[model samples]
Target: MSTTETHHALWVAYGASGVVGTIRKSDEGYTVTMAGADAAAGTYPTMEIAKGALHSHMTPGSDWPQFREH
Candidate 1:
């Protein structure tokens, strides 16, 4: 018999208005999706890059917080 473990990596970013965006670990890379968006903004090879992408996608003046594992 063999055992397999699965991991679902997820990170959330919050702002003054509430949930701002999220980064989900995918096979290709980290996928960043902004709030109320119809599709993902983009995908990055690393979490750091993904966070940066999410921040850049945020609207001006939005109070975004550090990404937290969720």
Candidate 2:
């Protein structure tokens, strides 16, 4: 038997600095796309969960890491 799949695309994050993200609905869970960093970061049971992860990564720290590791 041939199996079928459904795809649901959602624009979750968008704002200044050209930072954007998307959340796609899947049979298993949801997927998030934050900038060009991570395509398929991971699969979460819920959109909220996935969003939390995305936000964590998207949020920059107090300062950027130094170019030299030291």
Candidate 3:
């Protein structure tokens, strides 16, 4: 059998540069800001898609460094 873990994340698209802001739940829906700006409050159907959208808006070199360093 497989076990599933539930996570909640929020993502924001900041302007033309395509920068992304990500916020997520840590332990039991406790608010946790991952490694970016605080995104506007919203809900996504799945955590994977939400994370994918946040990654898609990365500004190449700059965003990668921030993501890696954190």
Selected candidate, larger lDDT, 1 vs 3:
1
Provide the lowest-lDDT 10-residue window in model 2. 61-70
Task: List model 3 lDDT by residue over 7-56, tens digit each.
Answer: 54444334345434553544433232333546434344455554555555
Models sorted by TM-score, best on top:
1, 2, 3
Q: Judge candidate 1 at residue 24 and give its lDDT.
A: 97
Candidate 1, superposed: residue stretches over 4 Å from native: 1-6
Worst 10 residues of 1 by lDDT: 59-68
By summed lDDT, the worst window of 10 consecutive residues in model 3 runs over: 61-70
Q: What residue pairs are clashing in model 1?
A: none
lDDT (tens digit, per residue) of candidate 1 on 28-68: 89999998999999989998899888988888766656778
- lDDT score for residue 21 of model 3: 59
Model 3, runs deviating above 4 Å: 1-21, 25-42, 60-70
Kindly indicate the candidate among 2 and 3 with the higher TM-score. 2
Clash count, predicted structure 1: 0
Task: Give the C-alpha miss distance for residue 22 in model 2, angstroms.
Answer: 1.4
Return the TM-score for candidate 2, rounded to 2 decimals: 0.60
lDDT of each: 0.86, 0.61, 0.43
